[model samples]
Target: MLVVYTTTLFMISLLIIDYSTYVLEYPHSFKYNMVKNK
Candidate 1:
């Protein structure tokens, strides 16, 4: 039971990191494109 709980917590943290990076990178890329076009 403890092992399962720890695994689930680890998975959740990984997902949060992935999602945060994606969210941050997407807007940064979009802004970069706009600047490049200008």
Candidate 2:
């Protein structure tokens, strides 16, 4: 159970890091998509 919890947390952190990097690289497109989604 501890291993599973650690693995899930690690994956979530990696995803957050990746997403932030993407947003930093494409702020305009990200914003555009957000507006379009609405």
- State which candidate has the highest TM-score: 1
lDDT of 1 at 17: 100
**Where's the lowest-lDDT run of ten residues in candidate 2?**
23-32
- lDDT by residue (1-38, candidate 1, tens digit) is 99999999999999999999999999999999999999
Q: Evaluated with lDDT, which candidate comes out highest?
A: 1
- Residues 2-31 of candidate 2 have per-residue lDDT tens digits of 999999999999999999988787988888
Candidate 2 backbone collisions, by pair: none
The list of candidate 2 runs beyond 4 A from truth reads: 28-38
lDDT, model 2: 0.95
